[model samples]
Target chain A: MAAKKLNIKDKYRLLTRDLDWDFSYEDPKKAFPYEEFEGIKITDWNKWEDPFRLTMDSYWKYQAEKEKKLYAILDAFSQNNGHLNVVDPRYVNAVKIFLTGVSPLEYQAYQGFAHVGRQFSGVGARVACQMQSLDELRHVQTQIHAMSHYNKFFDGFQEFSHMHDRVWYLSVPRSFFTDARSAGPFEFMIAIGFSFEYVLTNLLFVPFMSGAAHNGDMATVTFGFSAQSDEARHMTLGLEVIKFLLEQHEDNVPIVQKWIDKWFWRGTRLLTIVAMMMDYMLPNKVMSWKEAWEVYFEEAGGALFKDLARYGITMPKYADVIEKEKEHISHQAWWTFYTHGHAAGFHTWIPSDQELDWLSEKYPDTFDKYYRPMWELAKEQEAKGERFYTSGLPQLCQTCQIPMLFTEMDNPNQNSMRDTVFDGERYHFCSDGCCDIFKDEPEKYVQAWLPVHQIFQGNCGGPDVGDILSDYYRMNVGVDNMDIKDSPDEQRWNKWKGVA
Target chain B: MSKVYIALQDNDESRYIVEAIEESNPDATVIHMPAMIRIEQENRLVIERKVVEEKMGRDWDVQELHINLITLGGNVDEDDDQFVLEWKQ
Candidate 1:
């Protein structure tokens, strides 16, 4: 009789876990020093399950297939001038935000995972992190390649990596990853692997990808599908990591909870940009940010947290605040960007009359009440050859690094600002959530590379905002940064379509 | 009893899986959203490897289900031949 074939489980065990050796000469503690420092006790590495039973050979095979399929579509998109097919030139600004504001974070995730992949004593976790690190690297590469076609036809795409580092708003995402990468391995796992990949990724990807599809950007939509295929593995690993940490020892619960609270708040803040993109930037809207939040977070996350309740983890802190902010954040974020259009990497504009009506329909209680008036006034100003741009730099949250644009959930009229004196210096936060996070780690936050502060201190090359825009931020003055109404991007689109 | 669900991105790959799921779980209701397809069943839902393979007209790895999976609720019991989702009693 022929020998029975080895099943996937045994194959995975032999290929992955069996390869880990007993540390005889070098102390295992010396090998994985970061594990104990985070106060997460893993009593048994043996209990850690491989979330998906993908061995490296099969991982490469599947990923290769996805790459092949994705590249074919991307090549087709480029050859066919996919940039011209989008719903409007306004839609490309969303892609600009994504490439500049979001893509480098993928690179950061790669570095973060690659770092943690080495630090874990548990071979299962190390291998999981390694795979996710590769996925992040691939995601960044594919995202750039997918958007590269647009770079040829667009302006803001030129200085994405540079802008991510120096641009004021881009720091929100930049600092988020930096904070995660600098933490201990376990904290990194919870901050990114679990809280980000599992809890918040849908909010980021789904809206953007769906918006891409709705707006006829086939390259982005295809890449979104390809990246999302990898995301399943990342998401499962996130779930397994949290479960393993919680199940290992009772002491880990509170530490994990604290990380959850901090990262969840940070994740929400980081997603404010995505919320703005979903609501304001997409000419052909998929759904309002409020609706997406309701489905992805309130319904799906609610269920997941309910399941987590068994592990003594409840829904993250400030759930009520987050739920309420969904109705308000997109409007607030777009208004800030609209006012600061001259300083932004991408073009911004007042939403069309139809878009304003859509906002009113979507945000029944708040849109017509608070935000529409501002847009109307901006419209009137634009009509009279007096477009508005805020001359002074806004103060950024010390923790989240977002401009203090968000309002109190209860009182939408009032800016939700909080502050604390740390080491005899006052640091401001955008909300109670960010303020609490800052207070928890004042030493970490005090060292934040706030762009406005850097400009004031002359660390940024700026006697004038123009000098800063060109020399420091590398944004092309009058070309890359401004309203889409009469911008070159708009002119080019009209010329291509033979529209006056 | 509360419902259990699995959401998959609405695409070609998931169409076969959703069909397989519809055949396998008769009580389940499938709802299509903007870019996602959600299948909800009372208390339990299962995806059989054999059923998916038949619907796909090829060999199917149960792990491939993750390619388009958006989110899922309930306790999971997964292996090579079958993937089952249900709450603990």
Candidate 2:
């Protein structure tokens, strides 16, 4: 007779428990030095329960199957000229920005998880970190594989890793990841796993994937689907870590709270790119950033934070400030991108009348009042055959690294600017939220790799924007980035459709 | 009562979840849109772990529903084994 099944529940329990052994050879504290520095007190490993009873065997079995299905579809999509079915060249800009900025962060997360997976004292936490490490690596491969398929028919997909390292705008994502990675293991979990994955993941990820679907990008939709279950697990690990830390010691509440506040603000700032992608970059729309913010964050996140209030943790301090910025940040970010996008990878275009009307309808309070006129002016200049890009680099915030493009929350016309002197030098911030964060850890942030500052210091490919684009950014000028009228993707798109 | 509803992104991961939703809530009407899939039921929609597990041939947790979840309506009533959406919490 065949052996009885090692049923899922019992198997997970045994597998997780079997790893525990008496550490007579070395003191556990001496063995794991990184666990105690963050001041988190964990009394019992049993307090950490993995909501998903995943084990090694099942993990392997499930992941193997996903890769199989993913590659099969990727092959079919590539062979059939999937690029032709894509909605428009404008939509592919979303894909380009995603590939250039976000895909590398996946690789960064892979490294972060590897460190924590090794350093955590609790087996449950270690196992979760290990799985997350694997998940991040999986995301790295999957996103690049999907993006590489587009490279066959598109520009700007090359040199993504190099671009992420040196480009001016790429610093937003670079700093967001490295800040989390440089912290102690527990703080890293809070910074990324909880605040990033649990609180902010929906806002950044959902719209891009949905926008991909709307635009006939099947590979991107598949990338989103393939990672969904793993993302659910990552979020659970984050939530569970907070609960475990809180339950272990009363003092841990505030430390975790502070991390939540810092990371939430950081997460919001990092998502400025995603906000721009959703609202402006995608050719076919999903929903406005305002609506996505309302549905994904305001409603869902309200419930989540309320659930956590039982632990004596309230919401992040500047939560209301985020609500105010939502109506304005996407438009503000797009304008900056519109002017500087040529120096970067993708082309930026003036919104057609219909698109401008949609922006006005969606952003009724702010668009016409502030942004529509600017686009109208850009169009007017273009009508007379004048093209545009930022003549000089704008001032970047010390903490968030975003240029001082965001407007005052109450007064939409004025740039929401703040600055403070650390040591002897004055540092600029985009808003009160960023200024507050800078004051919290002035030293950690003063060391920030501000791209604009680096450029002026003559570290970036000399003084000329031409040298900066080609020598520094690898931009192919008119072919890689320009108006949608004569850009390479648009030309390819026209040629493909011209056949029909 | 208004229709009990949920929407998930359109992708391979959701196929099993959508199948499980259809299995548990027989009257569920699945609507396919660009990059998103929506489902509606008469007065209730149930997501059963047993059904999802059966579809994937592995264990599933109700929390896993969040991975594919775009938006869900009605009040959510959830437990370790199953999650149900109905008019009242």
Candidate 3:
């Protein structure tokens, strides 16, 4: 059967215009909120044009191709003994954190995208959202499949579902996403879609891809880059939606600006985990967190905000806070990872001499001052064939779930701490932002999915690290096959570098 | 010289793509508006239909242009004669 040729204009009219229905029971202004936000007058919603020019068939075809390519990489990685070649077993900890922390969020994005596909009035948008929905699902599945290989050698791999519910660290991401989901559709677009996708995801995806590629994890590198190609489309959606809202009204400037301010900070805070993983967790670090921040945020963010300034939005309120924290967020998160390695899905071993030298070169300031001392302590223990552990629970922030190492605003030395008592129980927070979130709804905060609590509950499928590995490495996990530590790629990498 | 219009939903990546295209194709004049981008010049403006199809992994008709347009800042009206791109000043 011959496929019927589809017209672009008709597709546009059918998607955006034809799908919308007037609500007889409620005013359209109240339903849409386009008019009440500010002084913007949409003389015509039809004037909006989605520049990427996507259709349903094209969306599926490209998406399927992306998935096919990603799955092939996963297959090759596992079939070829990928795990043995890892720089160290400890590096698997980073991959585990990624699988547990991020992979599930991809599934959430898939669900959200489905909602967007249905709610968005435009056919083109609906199609695009459908593609994104599928893309997010693919990301979740592929990530789980790729990391499932290390389930044999890692700890903390089994209880992610429970961990996310009870772990203080997860509160950062959980709260951030919950905030977005609770808002009206437009606010969701601005918070998760535009602000995060456009402003921050590249900072994360690019470095992750580069690090995976550099360290000889071919499957991870390929998947990261492939997934990012779709992210470019989302970034465009974010940008277009913001502008569309802005052009729709003059008063939207402030409302939009508030969202940018709120989301940018929220997104930046959640990414401290990424920054640490990129800068400190990788066995072969690419760039310092400070450098990534300067390039991705200071340069790119500075330029972007400057452009938006012409539209009357100022730089976010907490821009300076981010600027100052860039120097230390990596150090703080890595310290937490190191201290909590025994409880984590991955291991944390002391860096080799070569790795130490590399760190000295990458991080001139704190690498020697703060990290070197800790490494020296770990090295002393390693000589005795022992590894370090904190032996107690970390004092987690009531809000962000991060340890209270983040310094006070503009005071890098004084640890930022806020305390509040509810029913005579003291609650600690790293920053007021998180405290405010907790204060707004203590009940929600109390129910956070914390990874630590799950371990105590014995719900992680095992009583010990060895047993947990077996359960988490089940067939459904997909990553059960490839071992990056001993893989051919890692062997080849070691041989090429003359590093045994 | 005739003009080419490009529209971008204002953000970093679309802006980066516009800049990248401009960097690669210097002769093509590019203009940015609040919503999309416009690229215009007479020098054989082609989307490399074969490459696009290969990347997408399927056949696509020329009329499905609006569906693929993720960002549109201005008007790119392709009629019987010339392709027209315009923005409100």
The best candidate by TM-score is: 1
* lDDT leader: 1
The candidates' DockQ values read 0.41, 0.22, 0.07
Task: Give lDDT tens digits, candidate 1, residues A327-416.
Answer: 899999999999999998889998989999999999999999999999989989988999999889898899999999999887999998
TM-score of each model, in listed order: 0.97, 0.91, 0.73
> Can you give the lDDT of residue A83 in candidate 2?
77
lDDT of 3: 0.62
Docking class of 1: acceptable
Second chain only: TM-score per model?
Answer: 0.97, 0.93, 0.41
TM-score of model number 3: 0.73
Stretches of candidate 3 exceeding 4 Å from the true structure:
A1-10, A19-44, A84-87, A116-127, A152-162, A380-387, A409-411, A419-427, A432-500, B1-23, B26-89
Candidates in descending TM-score order? 1, 2, 3
Which digits, one per residue and each the tens of the lDDT, describe model 3 over residues A1-500?
89875555556556666766667898665554433343434455565666556556566776776677668867888888676666654465567667767777787778777775666544545666677788788887877777776554444466665555434455567666766766556677788788788768867776665666667676666566666667766776776677777877787788788778777877888899998788766777766677768756775556556556657878887688788777678767766666665444444445668877877787776578656777888778756866566675666676566667787655555788898877677788787766765776687667655444555677766675445444532322213223234444345446755786
Residue A208's lDDT within candidate 1 is 70
Deviation in Å, model 1, residue A363 alpha carbon: 0.5
Report every candidate's CA lDDT. Answer: 0.88, 0.81, 0.62
Please give, for residues A1-500, the per-residue lDDT of candidate 2 as tens digits: 99887655567677677776768888998888998888888788876777666787667777777778778888988999887788777888888888889889989989999999989877878888998999899988998998898898888888888899888899999988998998899999999888888757767666667777788888888887667547756776787788789889998999999999899998999998888888887777878999888866776566567667778988887999999889988888888888876776887888888888999999999899999999988988888888667688889999889888988787889998899999999999987878888898898898999998898888887778778888888878777777677777887788878932
Residue pairs clashing in model 1 are none
